[model samples]
Target: MKLYSLMTTAVLIASTSAYYVKNQKSETFSLNVTPVDAGTQEECKTCITFAGQTINDLLQFVLQEEVDVCGDLCQIVVDKTGKEALGVICTILCDVVGIKEFINAIQKADLDPIYFCELVPACPINDNGDAHFTSLEVMPKKGPQGEFDISFEYVSNNGTGTGMLAISVDTVDGIPLGDDFLNFAQPAGTYDGTIKLDAKENPDCDPTQGPCETWEPGTYTIHLSVCNGECGSNHPHSAIYDTKTTTFEITQN
Candidate 1:
């Protein structure tokens, strides 16, 4: 009888705790967005004007003073706002000095419950369209243990700017076979490159012994990324214009 009573008590306590946590998560949160300076506001008027009515109103409200928001309502905000408008707002917000404060306020308010990361843009607004890879192909899709050619076509919306292209080959599980190659000061356009799969490249397998000697006999993905401008080790300013994954297979003899 005493054990039964204890179990009932524990159950009641757990239920109460869950209810409290649920209520806490549903609690309202408030954030104070810093006001934009006159010069900054003037500079961003084009973005604001292009944001349309719904996002414009939200932008105005967020730029003013402290506002109360809840996760449920913020989800609605996201549904109503366009991606481009959010990108503009993020750009403007990041340009401001108090961006960290605003981010902190958002965290404290738990607004992320409604996918806040998706609502905020990470990169600055690019008037030019983003770069993209139109097509990627590997010649001799299945090759004996030897060198292969990879060709890819890319389009840069920012005109013919100099950039860096990084390429690497790895197994499906992400085990790198050879060193990553980087090409700098390359113009934005189609590129044809060569990669070798031999004992020297992998050193783990001996392809001379059989078809799968030097490298594993399976499919591998060639990862390629083109970044704008000279990308250093950190590549902070080097925004990725395009990324592509092309697959090639090594067949057994």
Candidate 2:
């Protein structure tokens, strides 16, 4: 219970910040939202789960203050994941998505419990017809998995250009397990599709070129973000349009 109190205090501190980042309608952050009562761990394995969304919100709120110190934290993520190319994401996520909006979304969790993935671009707040994610689901959410499929709908309200849907599979603590980038001509419409992923798909090293890291039996995070331009590691743009995410467990095969 002490852990919970410490965590809550951190969240309160973040809530009192005077800073305000603009959203779709140029609105400031608001913290009038209350967290849901997350149940026990027996029913929920990961904080990202539907029943555990409150936990996810609390985590994001607590980390909102960390953006100032993310230089060190971001390096740790890059060092562990070896994706030094996209290190800017760590800062972009925190700075772009303020804690005020997190609470606002949490109040509406009855309709949809948005995770961190949803929160980032979701953090961007789609109040102005900005592209946002919906209907995200991971197949066989739990089990001894060698393969899986991620299906979701992305609504783009912008012009047709090189839009990117970046996917990264990582551990709960931020170590990447694998990553994929879906770049396509996105116009004003909603695109829905399911991507097939295998345990053999490695993000660290390319299997086609050499040996790579395979999926292991553990809880992992699948993070997806949408942006207007090329968002590859080498290619960096200013912002992430939106995001969708889920967590799953991989058991022994």
Candidate 3:
């Protein structure tokens, strides 16, 4: 009789504790958006860090001062066609809030969830393999060689950096933006550029943000970083940290 009573008491206590814990806890949520041009494989991952256990909680989190939604925190606007939407999205770990409701909000607003990626070296040209910027030009109206010229000036720490820079522009359908610059497509696309800094320019030393010119029109994100060599280094390579991005419209004549 005594043993039976003890067992029953323990069971009841355990069950009650479990129930209380379940009711008190909330699920954690992570969201990311990567905006890619509709036609090309190129994309830019914009990260908006937020944490909440439930959908209502998550929405409250977004409503917070720190969390950024479309147009307010960041603006991903299509300049020509006046189309605005968010791209590249990763929402992992949803507990309570329905994914449908969350997605609907994003689709209605045309906002893409920002995604995250590993920190890759920005430049591979210099001996240090660090990317440097001296200038950038965005021709909202025209580009070099009839291609939208989103060009930049890269400098090295030793005054020498060499590497190929790839410019990827996203059109709604992979077709290059028009030459005359007048046929701006609606729901216009985004352009993300990645510059490969040559290994020769970096050699052994790292570069710092000395000076760089402003970028061209249209939405833009610029990143500059140093490449840590494959082998673990006994030599300390100082990190390359200097980046700035601004958006402006160009009125073509």
Candidate 4:
């Protein structure tokens, strides 16, 4: 049942809220990460469908706003006291014994995905992974000409499928770069910001199918690859499950 056709890969960085009021003092920052081991292939087996599917029905339809796991600790508030640090913060890391980690390690765990959606779980037939950070945007500093706007969200199926959402950065010496593809169509969703970054090989996302760049900051990484490709299209055209890889991280302070 590899009827692949699922691509919800996104990375957006917004700019021009008057360019953060014209850089007040330089604390400008933006960092976002969404990765919980996406969906470990073999058709797609995100922790064997939660083994018994209970952690609130596997996050009411698989995470959208927040779900915390891994040693029990979570914080994604990039910025909250602006007098000089505009704003931006997003952090997500997973694999804490999976299956939604007993309701994301409970501490009042209820981030709201329609209040656990209905215990999520419907893409199964090989579900094809991705459940976290349905949306994220951060812009700390660097405007006046740097500009910004970024977005990310995944999980869709209308029938036919194919997926690959990507964005990357880091190469002062670390080398991990990508900046191409604001949106790659299908029955997918969410793809904003089709302007800005006019130079440096042109890439706010998807300049022709690749990760191009010109923003030299510090550390960076952003990639989202979800390929269900209409479930392999009758296995022809050099068949190969299409694609599947969900990774996240965006940093600059």
Candidate 5:
């Protein structure tokens, strides 16, 4: 695991993360996609796709408070689908991949069940490749201000274990900050790094014009996005493969 560390102060940034929120398909979103003739790489395309989408739906249906509970949720879906076979395969793959200490890491990590099926014998890996963050660790959970550090690990399909990284921090209430981290260039492999940062009052806010911004004491979310090459702000030209967000609260010292 390659590790890099940096220290910096918080700057206000327009939260462009709204674009990443997935819009769930309508109430009647159908899971009926016909299997295409893709040779041997996708023999289980239909089953895998159906299972994967079902998993996604089950996950989304969970109440926000219980979103992280997957074991019971997943078991319910498998039972409902009448496809105990796939559940068995999932258990086998979960064990064989050793992705997490426990087999349910598949559900815990929210790994795309379809893409994960790529590990199955008949459903070969996608030729397009993949990139994602495996873990995010932070300290002083109260907030990301002075004397705070965040470490995260990521894996990508790029030949070299490097790629571009962009980070943004914002309050859940939609307060504005400065233009924070843009893009740190790296490669397309597995890498680990930490960044030390301090939260700041809105640097752009002027007291003469209005109240100088204060770092509110509440929940704030930090977003990290990685791209195969260049990352775009809007829909087109967006090659971002993975995005992860961690939330922390700010309190009076």
Candidate 6:
């Protein structure tokens, strides 16, 4: 486990019935939360007991009428306390139900943490090597529609673990694109696969429409992110090991 640090500043703000506005005056604070390995109920309880008061204060501040409930409360807490109290709150919350549960709770509350804590297996020690994207090749690179093949490699220098690859596209236009995710069982060596890049392939685009009608001619930015261990789990606990970006052109044909 790695210690997480959160930095924030306090600011005065004016409020109206409709909205809250920020003021110019402010103060800054830094917080560092120590990591704890908790697998049992007693361990979780003990961790929470130590930081109960700070968590209570955070909840109170977040529930205030003038506060932005959807925003990050951890930063606000850090600003208010100007100490490591915010980190303690986060550490306790994460230890209570693991990183996945903690993240789900934060998302459900529409709150953001300063930095997400990665999850490691409860029973086994994780010693997997980091995964990375080695190469990317697009077929018919100038066409309106084609396929992209990406290669990934990892070394089991530490130990054996699972890996995952997540890919997404961003167009010059604001139109939404689709994303693809794949999982790898092997912890070492190389893996490769292809993903279709046709506009009709996009679920958001109507299949009846022709490719030209559905896609705009321009450039698309592709993003690749790879993670090791707990790769297949929803709200995975593994950290992103590598990220790569590349561009493909869609020309009028």
Clashing pairs in 2: 119-123, 120-123
Candidate 2's displacement at residue 94, Å, is: 40
Q: Name the candidate that leads on lDDT.
A: 5
For residues 1-253, write the lDDT of model 1, one tens digit per residue.
0000000100001111001001011001111122223432223322222222234344444656454433322333456654444444444443442455434434432322111221232212322434577776777798755656565566654542323445556764444432322122222344433333331233444557533323557887777775543223232234566678988887775
**lDDT (Cα, tens digit) per residue for candidate 2, span 1-253:** 0101101100101121111111111011111212322332111112122212233333444457443354554454455546553344444443455545533433333323222334433212222334678767777898775656666676666632333455667754444444323233334676665555565433455457644455557887777776544343222232467777888888777
Question: lDDT score, residue 194, model 6?
Answer: 46
How high is the CA lDDT of each candidate model? 0.39, 0.42, 0.23, 0.28, 0.44, 0.40
Q: After superposition, which runs of candidate 5 have C-alpha atoms over 4 Å from their true positions?
A: 1-129, 143-145, 160-163, 178-188, 202-213, 233-238
To one decimal, what is the Cα RMSD in angstroms of model 4 from the true structure?
16.9
- What is the clash tally of candidate 5? 11
- lDDT of candidate 4 over 1-253, digit per residue (tens): 1212112232233321100001011111232222222232311222122221223333343454454443222222112222111111011113323436434332123432111211222123223422233444434223322444444343343421222233443344453544322111233233322112221224345646644455454433334333332222332111222232332232443
Which model is ahead, 1 or 2, in terms of lDDT?
Answer: 2
Model 3 over residues 1-253: C-alpha lDDT tens digits?
A: 0000000100001111001001111111111122222321121112111111122333333455453243332222222213232211223211122344443343332221111011111112224334345555554433222223343344334422211122223222232211100000112122223222110112333235321112223333322222221111222232332233322232222
Model 5 over residues 1-253: C-alpha lDDT tens digits?
1111112233212122111111122111111112233443233433343444455545454433253333555465577666665455444443444433322333442544333343333343322545688976667788534444666677756431112355666764475432223222223456665654455554665678754436667777778776532344332222567889887777775
Instruction: For model 2, give the 10-residue run with minimal summed lDDT.
Output: 1-10
lDDT of residue 208 for candidate 2:
75
Q: List the candidates ranked by TM-score, beginning with the highest.
A: 6, 2, 5, 1, 4, 3
RMSD of each: 21.5, 19.2, 24.8, 16.9, 16.9, 17.2
User: TM-score for each prediction?
Assistant: 0.37, 0.41, 0.20, 0.22, 0.40, 0.41
Report the number of the highest-TM-score candidate.
6
Lowest summed lDDT across 10 adjacent residues in model 3 is found at: 1-10
Which segments of candidate 4 are over 4 A away from where they belong?
1-121, 124-145, 148-164, 170-172, 177-226, 229-253
* Predicted structure 6: lDDT: 0.40
